[model samples]
Target: MTRTTVTARPAEPSVVARLSALDRWLAVWILLAMALGLGLGRAVPGLNDVLAKVEIGGISLPIAVGLLIMMYPVLAKVRYDRLDAVTSDKKLLVSSLVINWLVGPAVMFALAWLFLPDLPEYRTGLIIVGLARCIAMVIIWNDLACGDREAAAVLVALNSVFQVLAFGLLGWFYLDLLPGRLGLGDGQHLDVPMAKIALNVVVFLGIPLIAGFLTRRIGERRMGRDAYEAKFLPRIGPWALHGLLFTIVVLFALQGKTITSQPLDVARIALPLLVYFALMWFGTFALGKVIGLAYDRTATLAFTAAGNNFELAIAVAIATFGVTSGQALSGVVGPLIEVPVLVGLVYVSLAWRRKFAVRGRA
Candidate 1:
């Protein structure tokens, strides 16, 4: 008894402590990138015009490249063989579909009208943002938050399908039919061609998805699952963040003047977006927990529901309305608000995970 020795359990690392340097300072880096982009756009006279000219099938080439880079690594990390498990979860699938397709757009519609009643152009643009579900960048956010990769991939693919089929119809309903029925506007119709939406889905989601699938298949075949996951994934992981930063820089640079010049308008546009993101993220997360989803799938559901396809929204805005239009400006203001907000949500998701773990142990 006198010689008895006791071992104390080591304390778990805090969430912030566990993060890599890059992930830890994501907000600071994003803010810096935004500042740099804005400064460059303001300082360099012809930069926006130059950047604007580089387009592939009506999408900005630089932005497209950045998205592809950002998407590939996370997509590659998915265990494609296990996607069947994700698909078979009808509750998760149905819940995501309802939240994304039905509730999400409805909430944005109410918020846009509530917040920006006087500004029809901004209102319409926000409605358009609502219609475009997250397909590309939500994956990055999901990965960062340690959500189920396969579930995200499935949900993204599902949204992409709905995007091609329903985006135009939803656009008409929100922009044309609903407003007219409600006597909100002068019955301005927004015709978002299905072909354009289809093309975007192909380019943005399809290409990278195929690339990621093939990369995983080939890497696993060549290197075995252990090596592929342990060795190969680490090398490519950082590029996702790199691509995110690069996209932000280019995006802010393109809209720097507009963003800087129209501070009041930006603030106005930002308010509804802030409200919408908070509602969707927290509400969906709560819903997920209520439905008995584990933290991983719950996090996946929340992120996919919360994030918007700003890429498509911006492209649709610019293509339908002039690049200089309020619609396009509203679209530009989207990612500006979304980036930091969602990044903050990533930490929130992590904290919630820790809390749940502690409760389980108790």
Candidate 2:
């Protein structure tokens, strides 16, 4: 009898390692977009005007289309069949909802009020941003943090659905009614057009969600699941990143004059936003710890809770206000601040996982 020795193969790189060049250098791309936008806005005379002219119902047609492109690929990756897991782990789902929908909004409102009381329009803009739950970028954050992609997808889908249903009502309640009741803003009417809000939701979230589902279903049915995942999905994935970069370029280009003109004013919005991201992230992280959630899920909750759906917020701001309005400027600043902060949190999550995560949990 001959004895054969079986040697183990080297472990392969992670699924995240397979991310496109755009995803890997997202921050750099954002910075490049900002620089390009500012230069174009300063150099070119009428480009912004031309882009703004392509509008419908207060939403810039070009920007709106760009955002939809950005969102569809992310939604297509969601495994809707695994949605039952969200209900099975009721604690995770409930805690995420409370933190994202309840505590998250309250904290942003307070910070925005405390910091920008004099600037009512910008304050209202920040409040609108707070109400938006992250439905797209959190997937990238979750992937980076080595969290459960499937669960993150479930949460993202849930957040998108909730945003469509609740964003208008919540905007009215918090920004208008509660602020009025509390004597926060001067007796100015904060008209949150329900129709615009709903339209933005439909265009950005609902359409993408349905399109993603259909694409995935049809692709898998024709090509089979293995080929669909390996070939088709990866090819289309880069388009989302491309859309994101292009959208950022358009947004900053539209508001470049405003941003470059009042650097200090724009800088002020960052104060409350920075504070909000840190506080909400750590607060949610603590909650996950208290509930004994595994590190992956905890990371998921943290990113989901802390991340803002800046695309929706930006669209709402531009649609409700004008393209270059202070409200729109506030929304544009969100991604500028959010990218670095969330990236830092990704490092923090990774470090904490290494130090404290239970054996075998990560």
Candidate 3:
């Protein structure tokens, strides 16, 4: 006799739904976390020394373990099946990809070269920082913006796979094109040749990515996807956050004097990041509306356009040039500015929904 197979039910609406994606408002939580972190770093300036020195096998724990915790959930959520769908939309994807990798990096390079003081090492680090396409955290922004989660998933996975290969050339271009802006032949700039950039990519991106994928597979086979996210994954976030907190504390402690000294330079780097985010947010929205995308699809495109994977920025920055270095420091500063900015953009998306009512209707 042949037996028929039964499909399991999807999870019922629970607190997650009740929270109304906006009400759950992870952006607020992230902002609050950063606020607490800043307060702690300042009030307890000495805490940074404690969290800064985590090493195993001559490598730091942030790349080794902290990054694994950060990326696992994204891997767990991957639906390779969705990517193969014949009805898949390409307009949104193409627009987002072009803007993110092409427009975004080029704009960053030009703007940084224009304004950033002549510090070659700093310039190279900044360029490497810009070359990377975001991977891990942008999804949260997508969800908050009420985006097309499926599309977001596909593109994020696709970008993560591609960024590993592209980062080297992009990193080189930032330095080579922005000559004199980076103070060529300076001690700091001189060290960041091509080979080091490649090595840093493998250490930060390759290792955590492969490990996260494997571990995500193991967890799924064991507990099922729903159970794994609700149970194991939430537990991991706090620990990862704790690791981040520790790292921040150490970073602040190490730079406690410098932060006081270089507040002006901090302002310069921050201005570009802020503008980059705003441009990406609005630029994507305008294109989506022009294309007459559906509400979810437009939101997905805008989120992909607006937000970035600053987590990778931090890890790569630290591994490549030491966390205390200015480039690394600027990379760390990204999320400090990104979280609040994206939350505000989510609100802006909601406000502008009416402009593209066709996209919003569905």
TM-score head-to-head 1 vs 3, winner? 1
Off by over 4 Å in 2: 1-21, 144-146, 180-187, 315-325, 350-358
TM-score of each: 0.95, 0.84, 0.69
Would you list the C-alpha lDDT of every candidate in the order shown?
Answer: 0.89, 0.76, 0.58
* Candidate 3 lDDT tens digits, 125-172: 455556666655565556545555557766765666557556655655
TM-score-based ranking: 1, 2, 3
Q: Candidate order by lDDT, highest to lowest?
A: 1, 2, 3
* Residue lDDT tens for model 2, 12-83: 234336546766677677789878887787678887888778887666777777777877776677667656
Worst 10 residues of 1 by lDDT: 1-10
On TM-score, the leading prediction is 1
Q: Candidate 2, residue 12: CA error in Å?
A: 7.5
Range of the 10 consecutive residues with the lowest summed lDDT in candidate 3: 1-10
Candidate 3 global lDDT: 0.58
Over 4 Å off, model 3? 1-28, 43-46, 55-80, 117-123, 177-261, 315-322, 354-362
